[model samples]
Target: MWEKNGIKKNKAQNYKCTDCKKQFQHEYLYWGADINIKRQIIKMLVHGSGVTDIAKVLSVSKGCVIRTLVKTGTQVNLKSSKKYYHKVQIDELHSFVGKKEKKVWTVRRAIIYAYDAETDEIIAVTAGKRSKKQVKDLFKRLNDLTIDWFCTDNWKAFKEVLPYERHLIGKQFTKTIEGVNTSLRNSCKRLNRRTTARAAPKFLKESL
Candidate 1:
């Protein structure tokens, strides 16, 4: 049994467990400090709620949401449900980070995504300069998959690394992956066009 101990500093009534002598309050003074807020943050993130939107809805600060996202990201590990991929589509999206991240007027980062064309599921993702090296790192993550074909745009970078016979060029081969762009932009505020929200450099990969 828990008995009333005293009034907490937040004015909420505090209680003490008789067996363990542990103390707790039914309500918290800081909303973000609650464990449930972390769960709600993830729930809002998947349900098309942005940082600002979640802050308002949960009465927490934007910093709290970002911190929770970073922490939650570390705990998540998504493994491939399948072993082989016959066809895959590769794409890059242009996104921005605040000037604080680079000390420039604005920095544009290319987020590369590799999708299994057969199932329309993401295989790997990387973010940084749109160079051959970036694509190389993205491919490294998919090295375990027995990929038979890769479909990408006429971007010169991919040609330098991927084999010629296994590569398919042009947007026509990327129909399934193209549809994902719309869904991502619709659900993520940072990816939405004409948005003021900018992510920090470290969060680029975690947010994806």
Candidate 2:
């Protein structure tokens, strides 16, 4: 069926399988336009195009574009093996929903940023809902192997919830987190104006 649609088949070259040893034709299957569309989607994403924009350009649904991107293995890197930043920053940002007439609803998300303050390199990011319990849970889910200092603004929730593990609160201590919040806000168009309907919570979380 695929071969009838211009799919090409090549001889299996240097191919070995543990389950079975067979020399079968390796076929590449796709419609010509699909290849172009996929490349366009990837290129747009590389150029910092939002998912909605990519979908519009490709004439596909936003969900389809998102799933395709995920299938293509494009995702944010959240792991840092090196203990580059002993001190981490924490903050929260809110997103609003609803249009001109209806009252807007707000949803808050917590952002945990690990950064090398000296080099200004963002090492890792963890996001969750804005709540003492949620923030504490986020920390608990982290690998406790690294004992680094945590700094945040005088958010009383941090003082009460974060474990006694070298945490500090003060204006100076939270500068990095504040900077991160600014960067994150600007990166996602939905959050830039503060009045736009928030992106789906799951998508926003994944974007982090």
Candidate 3:
């Protein structure tokens, strides 16, 4: 199935017959078209690499990096398992896009999710205000699954939404979810409000 096609005008080697007579290239003059590069992009995003950092490291353009992030983004799910988790941790990570006309801007942009403690897999996620609605919506995603109990910090939304008997409200049980928050904060530049705000005063101002 390996049939060689002549090099393109860009001087990149071309091949065919591997994908139903479709023209293919082992290497493309066009940057960021490689499967390996895309995989590395995902890996770097998970490991706390910013867009510019990924673009520089992978020798791709920033636009390509941003596009990859928008299309594939990052998957927080740790493992693929069909088994239901008995103990699930729910938590939120607070971050803001930019300063608002008033305070309480961070509340407008937050991420809440459910994480399986035993399997280390993210079960469900929701973005926006960390309110009862968002928390309820996050739980809705796992409605088909069997969840014995939930663990969360002293968030009023949890108290309102979750069953009192099936919920464990404490810092200890929520450690895993909290760790996820930290990792996301470290990985995603959008979550590092203070760092980006402080570091890029000029850029931030210009954007605003």
- For residues 1-208, could you state the per-residue lDDT of candidate 3 as single tens digits? 8688898888777888776786777767765887678889989877777777788778999888767765663343333365567899998877544464433423245677788867777878776665799888877777778888999999899999988989999999898888888877776764665563334579796895
RMSD of 1: 9.8
lDDT of every model, 2 decimals? 0.77, 0.57, 0.75
Give TM per candidate.
0.62, 0.53, 0.55
lDDT tens digits, residues 63-179, model 2? 666556655642465565564356776665554444535322222344454555665666555455566775665466445437477777777777887766688778798786677
Q: Model 1 segments beyond 4 Å from truth?
A: 1-30, 74-76, 94-110, 127-134, 160-165, 194-208
lDDT for position 68 in model 3: 78
Off by over 4 Å in 3: 1-80, 96-108, 193-208
What is the RMSD, in Å, between candidate 3 and the native fold over all Cα?
Answer: 7.3
Q: After TM-score superposition, what is the CA distance of residue 88 in candidate 3 from its true location, in Å?
A: 0.4
Instruction: Give the higher-lDDT candidate: 2 or 3.
Output: 3
- After superposing all C-alphas onto the true structure, candidate 2 shows an RMSD in angstroms of 10.2
CA lDDT for candidate 3: 0.75
Candidate 2 clash pair list: none
